[model samples]
Target chain A: MHEAAARNGITARFGLDFPSFALDVDLVLPARGVTAIFGPSGSGKTTVLRCVAGLERATTGFLAYDGQVWQDEARRVFVPTHRRPIGVVFQEASLFQHLSVMGNLKYGMTRAGLSPEQAGLDAIVALLGIEHLLARGTKTLSGGERQRIAIARALLRRPRLLLMDEPLAALDLKRKSEILPYLERLHDELDIPILYVSHAPEEVARLADHLVLMDGGKVIAQGPLSETMGRLDLASRFADDVSVVLPVTIGAHDDDDLTRLDFASGAIVVGRRPEPVGRKLRCRIRARDVSLSLGNHADMSIVNILPATVTALGETPVPGHILVETALSGGERLVARITKRSSTQLGIRPGVPVYAQVKAVALFGE
Target chain B: MLTGDDVQAILLTLRLAATTVALLLLIGTPIAWWLARTKSRLKGPVGALVALPLVLPPTVIGFYMLVAMGPWGPIGKLSSALGLGTLPFTFTGIVIASVVYSMPFVVQPIQNAFEAMGNRPLEVAATLGANPVSAFFTVALPLARPGFVTATILGFAHTVGEFGVVLMVGGNIPGKTRLISVQIYDHVEAMEYANAHWLAGGMLVFSFLVLLALYSRRKDRVDA
Candidate 1:
């Protein structure tokens, strides 16, 4: 183990051989904020989270969280799941059927040798907006309500790390929207680092500060969310979902029923937003929605035209289309997907200035 | 109106049933838990052994138990070594035979309940800082309450209704080993039809009420 690296972040190396599949991964994740493990289905994302939670014992594995060794196969030292300070919310809201809502929340607190007041049970219940549900049975709660209770129960354990495995996958769209705000609040308020396993790109773009991309039981790419999402070489892997997440501030609401959002590079105006001015938000710009021209066209209807320089070009899965990687004057990156014919006609190359017209921008409220 | 002999028999029967149910519950819980959760190859053979008394005649179990507790049998030798002499024709002897005869009644329902719970609750409990032992007591036990209730009633009722095993092992001793079922059998043998009718009708009503309670509760659980 590298002492300096282990002290600052989580270090994990795991290898397992199953009859149908094999998993081998080496990861160093930051010790704070949400880090999403994103991949397609059957890509071993959940398995990675399970291994971290000490639920699945990898045949050959070593894991250390912020300098505390949890598993080391060579030393024959392994801490069992219950002994590790972790809170896990499984895909299904696995609340105890025999326990009431409040009973379920207190189950972990009692085991941790803390009373309800000491564990701050009331605050957690209020955070999840489940105070009215304390007296109800688990069977009668809706899917979203049950999930809220499950999250609250996990939190009451006072875990040092939290692992969520697609906690919203089982809920309908309406239920998902209802629960997403609570998750955002957790990401904002909680000091514990969260390891979230998700295959949904929207969830990753909206919530993750750091990203780990996986495929076929392996880690393909990992870094800060914006840096990794803008890599041209990995653009084909994202396929139609290639987009960049940019942190922007609500600048002002204009008189023409529009709101302006300002990032490092420049400002973009969109339909009126309900948030107050100066509030921070995240916006996603898809590669397919961007078009580049050699000279600015003032007569065009597009309002988000910004001058950028092409940095690199990479091949996409589509035969004729190519991915264009560019940098704004302020050092923020953007990607645009265009045809091979347009690339040759405009003689687009690295360091060539071009005007990028962003056709749409999707904003995610914080 | 019942005779003094009949009253004594009823008391002895209740005592035997209560003792057998208590012993079965203690011994059956771990076996049922293992059967419900184990993936070992011994599961098949062990399950078959527990269920053997359900299909085999009580006389067979009684015959083997009688031989085992006799003067020269292995159990008899051990008891003699421990200063217990022999166990046949004693209240203790009948209680052991009743436990063996009603083994399946206590184990199967509890095993079914544990199996129906799946592995989710235990996993949840473990993540909540409960060790395996703590989870069993806090989560698994409460979740399987219905199974315990069914097992208790079935074990007690089966022990009270057993005649062949008790008669074969206990030899119909008057107050010491004579139970309600054995007493009713002796009455019929003596051509005392009136006494037989009194004891037999009571047994019939008791059995009906037990089954009624079990099924009605099952219906309520289904409705819930």
Candidate 2:
């Protein structure tokens, strides 16, 4: 497993100390797809991203990207941020106020020794949907437009890795929604690994394939998104926002204003989605929306019920509540938060058979 | 109408101001950049030293400069060792003194501009593959342009209007050190009120126009 990871992964070990806070993290993240560094505010998510970009020098650090050491404090090998093949998008749009949109896009390209055509500047502009905004001055742009341009500028540098520090945090909800599609496009079309720092769980569920949960400058958990998010022990850290992300495909659209989503387990139905059949989507199922029953009730109003066995149970921060981990027949996992009394009443224990009724699913596009 | 002597003084003053502004900018940029970004304990002492010219009388600076450039002084000794002779009472002497006298005018504005820019642009530039020197020229320098404008204008205007420093360091060479302010003093002492009026009034109008242009441009930037 270690050999496989070393062949195609980023191995980062950083220890940084500040007066009020300290960051110590050792992460081995996959080289492809988006990996989210997630936690509540002040969990040192941004610090980890900064260390990877060489923006913050860790006191004791070892960082290697795909077997090439970018920083090794022991060997006295350190590549400065400019020398590293990485692009960064700060929280704010941070566009150069002195340059036009086109100028900003070309700013990194010229420095990277790549011509406009060579950097695929036109394709990137079209990818971010900023072609019409090329000649506009940065000051005249809206929040969403500026962020789009910033992303395009980062891409124009032809980076091997992209570090995004809450790129959507500074924008209002309206602007965030406006820019999310472009971000989704980048994830689909680009092959670069993205280290995204976000405190927003919804954004993580919608975008991330792997999850690294951090708290108080330490890694609490890290794994594939579904397995990590479904962990019973880490449920309380999510507080009232406990949920799991499932990779599902559009199986079919029923005539009765509903659509079926197929996962590794049996399919579940949601309200009719506009996406075509066979298109993949990520759906976040909040643990609070799931309920457990001792027997499958065919007469219930809930239509998406599947046979599951209780895997584990853990206490939540909420009074008298327990988070129950269950594995469906086909091995997909789900977490259902239930009252302690209800768990006892339903005989919900490890190895107990039960049915999981999913009350809601929030679909995120592929 | 201006006399030939008056024209010579005016030309000399312009030349001194131009030379002083150029020298101050070259020397002040690094100082201002350091003041803006450094966390060293020496920042306080260094900043106070730079601003000393703004508070102290110009004659105090001129007196020290005069002594330092005298034949017996250290700078004079170095100059002689280099076979360049003494510097006092020469155009070069007055130009050096003017640079010291106007140092604050050039450095403070640029420092303020760099501080206001924060570290975001430079960090962004670095992540975009610009080295430190490249970042400064491409990012820091261009963003601090308004400060440069302010510094150039203030440095030029302050150097042109200087009196005590020029009088102490350069004495009154005919076509070299006798600037407009000294010429105006000369006219008044000689009871040539008409001549003083022509030059001094010109100085007044010119200073006002320069300030007006600067402030209006600043207002435009603020509004934008």
Candidate 3:
């Protein structure tokens, strides 16, 4: 029964020593959602991803996914990369130069021994919006298009886990936005859990359900995205990226071309409505964009104001800044960064009621 | 002007060159692959040994081969023990000498090609579920086609042009070890100038055409 109780998702533990760096980490990741391993360059983010994919052999490792042991260094049971049922997307869209897009996709499907009916290459192409590129040469694709093809190729393998190493790091701003929707569709439709390695907080914020914060070749923090980002102790680390990810349902479009997004507490207005009413969305409001007031200020220039109670307060790395955690009317959480001088002047503390004037809300999809 | 002896020598030369090229390819691919991928300290020494024949005089190799393949030598002793006679002054003697004389010609091009391939394509193949052996044959070999062409031409041409090594090892046995280059030498020694001109002219044109074809095919592949 104890061994049967261990039947869960992926658990990866790795200890790798290089001449210039060493990485040691142990993590238990969810089996169904995207888990982001976020860190700066050389923070061992990609190294961890490679280890899970069996690409890099760690000195000491124990990796198991859904009760199957992929690696156990002590036992000398190491599954080679080719034998592991996983797919990887590198920073560069490393397509086979000799193969067209269709050829590349078919290569994965064939190698994985998945038939067209099983892998559904046609459905995947439709999902990634790569139907037009099937016959085209890989060399002819733009950076974003190539990356989309790469993602589709990886997905067509029907991998148990997908390891993506900074898939959008090589794209420009315009190209990133161009490929984001396809990624969102993948995160929505595919059952394959993804281990996404990235240095960009925005990418992590947009895509991740679970967050693993890495530093100095080790994991410093890991938890649900909303809770991890709102933690007072971790606020200083994510100082510039302190934002609440509020899941809201689209209510109605106002006459002034504003979309009404309703959460547990209240509705917030954003720029022109995107998806139709009733579609769920996530809105990210940065702490700095939020200003606190004792009561409602109707004459303020800010468009959105919601009542909240002070839950906690913490210091930021910047000397004059203080980050405030507040519970909205329906127990939803929000954070605001104000000056320490104002914190004392306003007598802001836990259990005190306040009004938060939000400057902008960046709406992302479910 | 071409006599029956001339025809025999030409046929023998073609046969020797073909056999040498085939053997070199079979033995050189793995050696070149190892040299390209190895990080061992012995790589430099082994590479120098393979390239030794490139810079050394053909007669020097021929002298060594003659001494090494004679009845009293180690290889000759082993061959006789195996029930085969000594290798010197025979067709196999010239063939063996030509393989040694053209080792670098077959190895260097393939080695350079493998090195230029880097590690990405093979890594990609591995991620696509190909083992190392399959990756080498499917991805690495196909991508290194131009190198194979260059190696084949160089190995064949160098074997056909072998004279001093063939003479030293085979003792100029007519229709047995007398290759095109050795036959030309004999014609010159016997004052048969016109026959020498025909064989020599044919070889010159043939080498040029082989090189031309290799370059064109390489360029076409690059363009494609």
Candidate 4:
């Protein structure tokens, strides 16, 4: 229901200036879908999520989202965390350790004013695949499973927005991979906008529809995945960064036991099973795994080759790994880790054309 | 047949213990919660006051109570003014003294439980959309069930065994304020070992069972 017309505008003004840091920068995020704020540790990423959820108020300014005005200091209005229509998943899982999983889920649902029917307990159970876990005590669950339950519990409240602070940060690599698909599902399926904070580049590439790149508590760059990622000069500043995302479609599978991915820029070869037709796939090429060749290669075991233009060449903070920012014809930017010796031997320079011999293409789950 | 005194004493003891527990629950809970959660500068003095009965000579509390509730004391004058007559040496006076003397027994367990439970659960409940008061009932009190059990049993048991305070304040007045402890002491002084033995033995069994229930219930909560 549309609240009184006065309640209709939801613009979250997240600008916080700390003594030696700025926790957040200004932005008006879209009202729907997942908006992942990606940054490294100590970069004030979680502070942004905290400010939006009203767990910690921004030092100054207002939170406006949807048509509802959640916070405005000028109007002397600030909703406390309890009154705010926000659900947060802390990195620690934050499950009610004393209560059974079902009890924990009901703890929020019972207080949300909506009945069980409105929140759809059964539907959320199926959504997160937590039906088997519902009756178990929350403490007994594994890290990955606990995060899934946490997400489910937050979603069950039917929140206006979900703020997750690196919810999978504590999980192991295997657990992280398993939770990724479920998170991807939530991103695509849920109606509420999610402000997910993570420093994981691959995660940002796969799950985020909009990326707010933060560094030192400032919004350094932000836009749709492809548009902002092209600022190869901007992304080059992050030290020892790996993997550059390439948005490509499954062209077809190869007989030599590999999946052929056709990017608008160039085709890539990866070892993955058959995927359904026409679905977009994010092929992750680790910067270190990709080596540059001045000319086309003939004897290499590497299966995929692409003609990439040298966009920016700079020495990485960590020596030996030269940061190569290259662009595909489709305008998708890819960061590669090539050795300086190869840079000099190939006479590599900015604006020079080269072949990106991708050693492996890790296809993200659809 | 046995004399009427023993039966009357038993009835009086139960009435005293029950009333004492009710009164303690009313006053002790808020104080326990405060001791558990407060960061105020008043904590040290309040804590020392609550635990005074555990170490202070019972006769000291009794002596002060007697002086404070005498006909000329403030409370005694006020009650007499309201037409209640003298309060000390009465059943109501014994109940009041028992509550004061057994406060530590009721408050310690509740305070420990609240401290161990911490503020996280309450904060989580707040973020879940429940107000503070509702969160206390739904989250905090339920989790502190073992503390409540311990407080109730200890307070009741301690009140049942009260002697010095009742002797000083209630003055061994039968059918009005005489409790089991005073009755047992009277039987022994009169060399009626049979009456004293039965009364003392009954109290021993009652106290043992109360402790067994407390320990076992605490174990169950720990396991849960």
Of the candidates shown, which would achieve the greatest TM-score relative to the real structure?
A: 2
Off by over 4 Å in 1: A315-320, A339-351
Q: State the C-alpha lDDT per candidate.
A: 0.91, 0.92, 0.88, 0.79
Cα lDDT of model 1 by residue, A1-366, tens digit: 455677877898899899987999999999998999999898899999989988899999989998999998989879999999889999999999999998999988888888888888888988999999999999999999999999999999899999999999999999999999899889988999999999888788888889999999999999998888778878866887788889999999999999999999999999999999999998999898999999999998999998999999988887799989999878888999999999999999999999998999888865
DockQ, every prediction: 0.79, 0.88, 0.60, 0.46
C-alpha displacement of B175 in model 1, angstroms? 2.5
Clashing pairs in 2: none
Clashing pairs in 3: none
Return the TM-scores of chain A for each candidate in numbered order. 0.96, 0.96, 0.95, 0.87
Residue B116 lDDT, candidate 3, scale 0-100: 92
The DockQ-derived docking category for candidate 2 is: high
For model 2, residues A180-247, the per-residue Cα lDDT tens digits are: 98888888999999999999888888888999999999999999987887787888777777888888
Which stretches of candidate 3 lie above 4 Å from their native place?
A1-6, A235-239, A314-320, A344-351, B1-4, B72-74, B215-224
**C-alpha positional error of residue A74 in candidate 2 after TM-score superposition, expressed in Å:** 0.6
Docking class of 1: medium
* Model 3: docking quality category: medium
